[model samples]
Target: MAGRILIVDDVATNRIVLKVKLMAACYEVLQASGGADAIASARIDQPDLILLDQMMPDMDGIAVCKKLKEDPETARIPVIIITADNDNTSKINALRAGADECMSKPLDELCLLARVRSLLRARDMSEELRLRDSTARELGFAETPASFTPSATIAMIAATPVTAMAWKTALGNTLHDKVVVIKKEQALSLTKTQNIPDVFVIACNLAKPDEGLRLMSELRSRPETRYSAVVMVIPKDANNKSATALDLGASDLMIEGFEPQEMALRIKTQIRRKIQADRLRETVRDGLRMAVIDPLTGLYNRRYAMPHLARIADHAKTSGRTYAVMVLDIDRFKAINDTHGHTIGDIVLQEVATRIKDNLRSVDMVARIGGEEFLVVMPDTHLDEARMAAERLCHVIDDRPVILAGDKGNIAVSLSIGVAMGGLHVDVRDVGQLLESADKALYCAKSDGRNQVTFSRTAA
Candidate 1:
């Protein structure tokens, strides 16, 4: 099933109709007869979306939507209110009550399906981010939402200056966002500038229906504007353009001759969604960075290195290819910190990391596993190749002194490397065993001389 959708209506026929339509689209459908049952089903079944009838026997859709929003468990599931009423007041009430969308009795199946797919995509993305956030919280990485303000920047693209100016006036009256009017030639330039719009309103059929569509395509293809929400304005008779816009990644659609109030509401909805998406994206990015990266050295940390070592082990075993694991330690790193201030010590560490990173092949993985220790994994490498690489890295450190800020003279630094080769069935094969071998070699290197490479003895 693509997603699970719950249909809530007191009338059996209404439930059946919606169920059939959704099932035809390969969605798993659930049914609820009234508000009570709807809330119960939403909490227990956790449906991806809910389609609610406006008028019910006991509780109305507006009240039901409020109840759903109040409950934390079901608050995230999107609700679409279906009503026979055409009054703008009804639309306002539904939207205020937390309905994601509102549709009249004679629903356009194309529009309905497009809205459904769009809501499901958004819901899934949010849920995934929420799950990752939960994991991050457990790991003590707390992520906060990005700051948002009512005064956002919105760009409207139209063919004629008159139409664009008119829209700017209407939207400006209703929204706090800074509304800017632009033409096709200037639309692509926004992608290059730092002042990109929070939401893009493209009026299709401005010159031609395809012009706005091509703009939408370009915006979605570009990395800068791909995540920004887009709402397409189409002529009332242009059903084809509406459908194509949705397929081309338009977030919302406005028919020609739409009320200024309704347009304002739609734009507000799109902006809120864009903000939520941006926040979710930032949270997930922060979580991933915390998991893998070392904050001080900007290198992969031990948390990321262990699994990578296992991957190298698995590949070497399966491909019967030789791989090398090296454990490196800075010589007398504590003495450097003890003699010079820790600030200078930090500069030295940063410089050492840069040299180590610069000396390795692109395929090699280097991670800062401890305060002064690093782990390097080289796949498909021979013993001689590993030794040569380690020697070069060692030379890079001892060759030049790290320059410090504040006119401090350069400080000499060196590295002691321990190399262990794997791929033989008889020798240390797994990551744990390989690390043990490398550690012993590292200890031997430190004992023999401060800045030298030592190879581990292979098993029979």
Candidate 2:
């Protein structure tokens, strides 16, 4: 099935007709006879989108939409209210009640299907974010997003400056948001560092007919503006471009030229949805970063290093190049912790990590694998080069003394490193065995002396 859609109508004929249309498009259709039943089905079935009838004997579409928005379980699902009334007031009321779209009866099939596809695509994106947010919450790495939303900026672009300024003035009377008038060229030329708008209100026809749609496609393709909400305004006499607009990634459509109050409502809805999605994306990124990074030293943890090392080894084998792995440990870290307290020991560890990182090339990977222990993987490096690099790392750490946070004294620290070679004419193919070889060399280095570099016996 392409997606699951719930059809809510009081009349049996209306439900059947809508179900036929949706099922023909390969959608799994669920039907409800009234508003109350629709809400119940929405909560239980969790459809991806809902096609709601405006008038029902038990409850109106506005009341039903409000109820669904109030409930957490059904709030995120997109709802489109299909009504017989074609007045601007009806559309505004439905939008204010939280309907994602309001369409008059005798629906244009092309536009209706396109709208369905668009909303389903958006719903899928939100679902993926919700799943990630759930995972982050389960790991205790993310918190619920705060309710406060910052003021948004909306950019209006029209075929002529007069129309654009007119929109700005009209919207200014209703929307407190900053509305800027810009030419189509300026909108297309916006860069990432520039002040990008939260929402873009575009006229369907720019200098040429349907030129604004071309601009919409351009904005959608650009990384900097792709996430911004786009609303395409169609002229009253213009042919139906709603289907094309929705298919090209428009967030909403104003079919009947510009009505200030309705446009304001739609823009606000788009802004709220965009803010939510942006917050979810940020939270997911933070959670992912927290999972693989050592909070204390700001270095990649063992969980991220192991697979990364394997990738480097694979690349080396394919490119017929040799790579080096070094496992290093602080000399007598426990003694430092016991003598100077763990706080000083932590400072020493951070400084040592910084020194090791500074000495290596960008191609080299350094990670805090354990307490006072680190792993470095250098790709396309010879055995001699690896030995020299390890020795350099040892010297840098031993030469420097870590300063305590307060006016406390300094503490001298040193690290022991074990070097192992892999890939392209080396015997070790398995990552586990290669790591074990380095670990064995590390043991030898520790056994021989506290602060020195040792090479594995198998590393030619």
Alpha carbon lDDT at 92, candidate 1 = 74
**What is candidate 2's lDDT per residue for 1-460, written digit by digit as tens?**
6777999998999888888988999888999989999999998888889999999999999999999999998998899999999898899999999999998898878888999999988886776566556645655778877888888889999888898888888776677788999988788889989989999999898889899999999999999899999999987744358888999999998864657988889999888888998999998677658697888888778876776677677656654568899999999999999998988888888899888899998557789999989999987677889989999999999987888766888888888988889987554358778888898899999999778998888894
* lDDT tens digits, residue span 1-460, model 1: 6678999999998888888999999888999999989999999888889999999988999999999999998898999999999777888788888888888887778878888998887776665455445545555665565465446678888778888788888765688778888877776776455877888899886687478999999998888888888989888766667777888888888777777877788889888877776766676476658677887787778876776667666646654568889999999999999999798888887888889988987557788999899999887677888999999999999999898777877899999999888884623346788888899999999999879999999711
Clashing pairs in 1: none
- Candidate 1 off by > 4 Å: 146-150, 290-460
lDDT, each prediction: 0.82, 0.86
Model 2: pairs clashing at backbone N, Cα or C within 3 Å: none
Reference-based lDDT, residue 137, model 2? 68
Q: Candidates' TM-scores? A: 0.63, 0.64
Candidate 1, residue 60: CA error in Å?
1.5
